[model samples]
Target: MSLVSQLKTLATRVGTEIKGLVRPDHPGLARAWVNFGYVGSAIQISSSHNVAGVARLAAGRYRVTFSTPFADTNYCWLAFARSNTNSNTQRMAIIRATTDTKTSAYVEVICATATGSLADTTEFNLMVFR
Candidate 1:
């Protein structure tokens, strides 16, 4: 190869090596740098209906509430389902985000009453980020 071509190849190889060294499989990190928690809820109901308004649980709800940090954004996901059913009752399933002073987004899971006749106590699983 010509001298100029050989020099170009060497510079490319050196750049690649430097990048590899900068990013290892795992860098040493202190445990304090990681934050984690859980939030959830449970509720009971006697009839079929949709609950209105948002309740601010320990872990926030996922509906598009004014308080939802992700309400204005399109990058949020909601996962919920009813776990039990009978002739006299149905449960509401809900998932949402948790907000702090910084309003960081987190996941929450819960089941509530769809009808006013039933009662539900919600327990959420919360997780704080790194």
Candidate 2:
């Protein structure tokens, strides 16, 4: 092969590798994510990837199920939430529920008011990584 053709082939391969590394579907990146909230007392999933569904257990408590189960229960996760009116400060906790396996996560969203009680929010987001 000509030198120019060989260099072009090498450049294409390098570009493909870089793209794979940065793609959302990459094996080393996040496996699941969801943006959810309550709309008129019903759960609404605005957007998600690899998330099967979200269920509201009680006020400020929810369960997120993954479409594909992980190999084990060793994954890491992040959770965030905000108040409906955006007036109250919010704090969130991502937990492994007693019934959760490698395919689900449980989360709690609390509003930090003067009383410091657990309250539900308007929106919650979760991301899971393996």
Candidate 3:
């Protein structure tokens, strides 16, 4: 190939790599749930308490597989809802996993610090991706 053509090809290859690194692939959607009395309030990441759930998929009655990547140790990089449809009461936060495998996460719901509305119950659906 000529010099100009070679340069163009190199540029194209670099562009492709950059795009792949930056743009993540959407692995469709998946779901998880919390029980009625689960205290999913806030990202409780501490030496004493680390509140997080592993994203997983079940394979019949044999093996358990995690669709998303998760660490054995927990961190405080998740979000949760007070209820099913209370967007106003939902707590949003930026979660950063320890790895970049783009799989799995541990999320927590923000807690309410009050007398009447401190404790709550709810279930939530998580958008799973890789």
Candidate 4:
């Protein structure tokens, strides 16, 4: 390729990459650049997270698969779940998320009501930072 043409192509690629790294507009995620969330039955990774994918392990539990796994168990991450419009109450506050110590391949988020019952398809969001 001509030198001018090569430079133009490199600039375009860099611009596109910078745009893709922008984070979601969530206050809680200010410190955590990674962002992924579920909307009803669908799960999607925001531009910031750059994750591999997400899967519903159960009603309230989700497995977030990462494109690049964290370096270790000490990786900082957060998870939160909210009840859908059909099911809203204080119980949603009891939702919780956690990861295992053996590996950083994936983080599992489990959401439950205060009564200890799994919330049905609850909306959940997760963020991780190394």
Candidate 5:
């Protein structure tokens, strides 16, 4: 093949590899993610990818359902939260593994106040990886 043809073939292979790396089902990409918060006592999802829905079970507890289920219950997850209250308290977001499944997971947001109470946060973000 001519030099130009060889270069063209190499470029096409590179482009195909890059597209595979960024596919939605790529292993390096998050399987599901959601950004949610409360709006006047109701849970509101601000943005999401592969997340079907979010439900508030209690004060700081929530259930996040995925649009596509994982192969098993071996996925990893991350959570972050920030309170809306004007206080200097620290906050923590935790995933409840006991309630985790191929289709959904649970999260709880807690505040580091005197009571170490579970509280609704102004913003909550969750991500899942398989």
Candidate 6:
């Protein structure tokens, strides 16, 4: 084969190898992240687990329903975002309930202070990762 032809073939193989090395989302690899939470008014989901129900367990405590249980009680990590981002000093905690079958979240300072509190918010979203 011509010297030029051999060089071209070698270049093509190197380029292909480089492309494969740089592609992080290659089909053979599993995703590095997964969605496991929801935005609610009527309630919507973003996880592999299915939503079975939702309810207010108490004054400032809430529950989210998952049809199937999580692999481990401590595996879930959760966060929240309120629709009103104008201002706030309040905070929320979305965590796995002590009871495995029951999922709950705690919101502090709910309707406590008019400013920077849950009293001024309309909607919220939850984000979970395992």
In terms of lDDT, model 1 sits at 0.35
Model 6, CA-based lDDT: 0.42
Name the candidate that leads on lDDT: 5
| 26-106: candidate 4 lDDT, tens digit per residue | 333433333445565676555555467777677666666777766676666666665555554532423343342224777
- C-alpha positional error of residue 92 in candidate 5 after TM-score superposition, expressed in Å: 1.5
Candidate 6 per-residue lDDT over residues 88-120, each given as its tens digit: 455454343444343232211122233433232
Cα lDDT, model 4, residue 55? 74
lDDT of 3 by residue, 17-105 (tens): 87777643423323332322233543222211221343222110001123344544232233333443445444222233243233244
Q: 34, model 3: CA deviation in Å?
A: 6.1
C-alpha TM-score for every candidate: 0.24, 0.68, 0.24, 0.55, 0.71, 0.38
Backbone Cα, N, C clashes tallied per candidate? 22, 0, 8, 0, 0, 0
Reference-based TM-score, model 1: 0.24
Query: Global lDDT for candidate 5?
Result: 0.72
Deviating ranges (above 4 Å) for candidate 4: 1-48, 86-102
Error of 4 at 70 (Å): 1.3
**RMSD (Å) per prediction:** 14.7, 5.2, 13.3, 8.8, 4.9, 8.7
TM-score-wise, the better of 3 and 5 is 5
Per-residue lDDT tens digits for candidate 2, residues 85-121, read 6565545653545654344343333333235555566
- Cα lDDT computed for each candidate against the true fold: 0.35, 0.70, 0.34, 0.59, 0.72, 0.42
Model 5, position 115: C-alpha lDDT score: 58
lDDT of 5 at 7: 100
Could you tell me the lDDT of residue 76 within candidate 3? 22
Ranking by lDDT: 5, 2, 4, 6, 1, 3
